[model samples]
Target: MNENKLKSLTEALTELASAERYEAELILKADPDTVIAQTVAAVRRSFALDIEKLLTEMGFLDPTTPEKCRQSAEAGT
Candidate 1:
Protein backbone atom coordinates (compact mmCIF):
# COMPACT_ATOMS: atom_id res chain seq x y z
CA MET A 1 0.00 0.00 0.00
CA ASN A 2 0.94 3.61 -0.45
CA GLU A 3 2.15 5.64 2.50
CA ASN A 4 -1.09 7.59 2.93
CA LYS A 5 -3.29 4.50 2.74
CA LEU A 6 -1.04 2.59 5.11
CA LYS A 7 -1.15 5.42 7.61
CA SER A 8 -4.93 5.62 7.42
CA LEU A 9 -5.27 1.86 7.81
CA THR A 10 -2.93 1.85 10.78
CA GLU A 11 -4.90 4.62 12.46
CA ALA A 12 -8.23 2.94 11.87
CA LEU A 13 -7.04 -0.49 13.08
CA THR A 14 -5.46 1.02 16.15
CA GLU A 15 -8.63 2.86 17.04
CA LEU A 16 -10.76 -0.21 16.48
CA ALA A 17 -8.49 -2.45 18.55
CA SER A 18 -8.34 0.06 21.39
CA ALA A 19 -12.08 0.52 21.54
CA GLU A 20 -12.78 -3.18 21.40
CA ARG A 21 -10.22 -3.95 24.09
CA TYR A 22 -11.81 -1.40 26.42
CA GLU A 23 -15.25 -2.82 25.79
CA ALA A 24 -14.00 -6.38 26.33
CA GLU A 25 -12.36 -5.42 29.61
CA LEU A 26 -15.58 -3.95 30.91
CA ILE A 27 -17.70 -6.88 29.82
CA LEU A 28 -15.22 -9.54 30.91
CA LYS A 29 -15.26 -8.34 34.50
CA ALA A 30 -18.50 -10.18 35.06
CA ASP A 31 -17.65 -13.81 34.14
CA PRO A 32 -15.96 -15.65 31.33
CA ASP A 33 -18.91 -17.95 30.67
CA THR A 34 -21.47 -15.16 30.64
CA VAL A 35 -23.31 -14.39 27.40
CA ILE A 36 -21.93 -10.88 27.31
CA ALA A 37 -18.40 -12.15 27.74
CA GLN A 38 -18.86 -14.67 24.94
CA THR A 39 -20.34 -12.00 22.73
CA VAL A 40 -17.43 -9.69 23.39
CA ALA A 41 -14.95 -12.42 22.52
CA ALA A 42 -16.77 -13.12 19.28
CA VAL A 43 -16.78 -9.44 18.48
CA ARG A 44 -13.06 -9.21 19.12
CA ARG A 45 -12.37 -12.09 16.76
CA SER A 46 -14.64 -10.56 14.16
CA PHE A 47 -12.79 -7.28 14.44
CA ALA A 48 -9.57 -9.08 13.56
CA LEU A 49 -11.23 -10.65 10.55
CA ASP A 50 -12.60 -7.28 9.56
CA ILE A 51 -9.14 -5.79 9.73
CA GLU A 52 -7.75 -8.55 7.53
CA LYS A 53 -10.56 -8.09 5.03
CA LEU A 54 -10.00 -4.36 4.97
CA LEU A 55 -6.28 -4.82 4.35
CA THR A 56 -6.94 -7.29 1.54
CA GLU A 57 -9.45 -4.95 -0.05
CA MET A 58 -6.96 -2.12 0.19
CA GLY A 59 -4.31 -4.28 -1.56
CA PHE A 60 -2.14 -4.70 1.50
CA LEU A 61 -2.83 -8.40 2.04
CA ASP A 62 -2.33 -11.19 -0.45
CA PRO A 63 -3.88 -14.43 0.73
CA THR A 64 -1.90 -16.54 -1.71
CA THR A 65 1.45 -15.16 -0.55
CA PRO A 66 1.15 -14.07 3.07
CA GLU A 67 4.90 -13.85 3.72
CA LYS A 68 5.40 -11.42 0.86
CA CYS A 69 2.43 -9.41 2.04
CA ARG A 70 3.90 -9.24 5.56
CA GLN A 71 7.23 -8.16 4.20
CA SER A 72 5.62 -5.48 2.04
CA ALA A 73 3.57 -4.21 4.94
CA GLU A 74 6.59 -4.12 7.24
CA ALA A 75 8.65 -2.34 4.60
CA GLY A 76 5.77 0.08 4.04
CA THR A 77 5.75 -0.49 0.31
Candidate 2:
Protein backbone atom coordinates (compact mmCIF):
# COMPACT_ATOMS: atom_id res chain seq x y z
CA MET A 1 0.00 0.00 0.00
CA ASN A 2 1.01 3.58 -0.50
CA GLU A 3 2.09 5.44 2.60
CA ASN A 4 -1.23 7.24 3.04
CA LYS A 5 -3.41 4.17 2.59
CA LEU A 6 -1.15 2.11 4.79
CA LYS A 7 -1.42 4.68 7.52
CA SER A 8 -5.19 4.82 7.20
CA LEU A 9 -5.51 1.03 7.28
CA THR A 10 -3.20 0.79 10.25
CA GLU A 11 -5.28 3.32 12.12
CA ALA A 12 -8.43 1.46 11.18
CA LEU A 13 -6.95 -1.81 12.43
CA THR A 14 -6.11 -0.20 15.74
CA GLU A 15 -9.62 1.15 16.11
CA LEU A 16 -11.16 -2.15 15.17
CA ALA A 17 -8.98 -4.04 17.61
CA SER A 18 -10.00 -1.67 20.38
CA ALA A 19 -13.67 -2.09 19.56
CA GLU A 20 -13.31 -5.86 19.52
CA ARG A 21 -11.57 -5.83 22.86
CA TYR A 22 -14.39 -3.78 24.38
CA GLU A 23 -16.99 -6.11 22.92
CA ALA A 24 -15.11 -9.10 24.33
CA GLU A 25 -15.20 -7.57 27.77
CA LEU A 26 -18.91 -7.00 27.49
CA ILE A 27 -19.35 -10.56 26.28
CA LEU A 28 -17.54 -11.80 29.33
CA LYS A 29 -20.04 -10.03 31.59
CA ALA A 30 -23.12 -11.08 29.64
CA ASP A 31 -21.97 -14.73 29.41
CA PRO A 32 -23.93 -15.26 26.24
CA ASP A 33 -22.18 -17.45 23.68
CA THR A 34 -24.31 -16.13 20.82
CA VAL A 35 -23.50 -12.53 21.62
CA ILE A 36 -19.81 -13.30 21.81
CA ALA A 37 -19.89 -15.14 18.54
CA GLN A 38 -21.78 -12.34 16.85
CA THR A 39 -19.42 -9.75 18.16
CA VAL A 40 -16.44 -11.68 16.81
CA ALA A 41 -18.16 -12.11 13.49
CA ALA A 42 -18.70 -8.39 13.24
CA VAL A 43 -15.04 -7.75 13.81
CA ARG A 44 -14.12 -10.35 11.20
CA ARG A 45 -16.39 -8.68 8.66
CA SER A 46 -14.65 -5.36 9.19
CA PHE A 47 -11.48 -6.97 7.81
CA ALA A 48 -13.10 -9.53 5.55
CA LEU A 49 -10.97 -8.79 2.52
CA ASP A 50 -7.81 -10.74 1.72
CA ILE A 51 -4.75 -9.28 3.41
CA GLU A 52 -1.98 -10.38 1.01
CA LYS A 53 -3.95 -9.19 -2.01
CA LEU A 54 -4.55 -5.91 -0.26
CA LEU A 55 -0.90 -5.63 0.65
CA THR A 56 0.21 -6.42 -2.90
CA GLU A 57 -2.31 -4.18 -4.62
CA MET A 58 -1.61 -1.45 -2.14
CA GLY A 59 2.11 -2.08 -2.66
CA PHE A 60 2.63 -2.72 1.00
CA LEU A 61 3.90 -6.31 0.67
CA ASP A 62 6.27 -6.95 -2.18
CA PRO A 63 6.08 -10.36 -3.88
CA THR A 64 9.29 -12.05 -5.00
CA THR A 65 7.89 -14.12 -7.84
CA PRO A 66 4.84 -14.90 -9.94
CA GLU A 67 3.76 -17.54 -7.50
CA LYS A 68 4.09 -15.12 -4.63
CA CYS A 69 2.18 -12.48 -6.54
CA ARG A 70 -0.66 -14.89 -7.17
CA GLN A 71 -0.64 -15.88 -3.55
CA SER A 72 -0.81 -12.30 -2.40
CA ALA A 73 -3.53 -11.54 -4.90
CA GLU A 74 -5.54 -14.44 -3.61
CA ALA A 75 -4.87 -13.25 -0.09
CA GLY A 76 -6.22 -9.77 -0.90
CA THR A 77 -3.04 -7.84 -0.04
Per-residue lDDT over 1-76 for candidate 2, one digit per residue giving the tens place of the 0 to 100 score? 3688979768765765686677678877896766776777765665444444455666666755558767999999
Model 1 / residue 67 / CA error / Å: 17
lDDT of each: 0.78, 0.67
lDDT of 1 by residue, 1-77 (tens): 48999898989889878988887777677675765845866886788777878788778878656578779999999
| Predicted structure with the largest lDDT when compared to the true one | 1
* TM-scores of the candidates in the order shown: 0.55, 0.44
Native-to-model Cα distance after best TM-score fit, residue 46 in candidate 2, in Å: 6.0
Best by TM-score: 1
Clashing pairs in 1: none
Cα-lDDT of candidate 2: 0.67
RMSD of each: 7.7, 6.9
Task: Tell me the deviation in Å of residue 65 in model 1.
Answer: 8.7
**Residue ranges of candidate 2 with Cα displaced over 4 Å:** 32-77
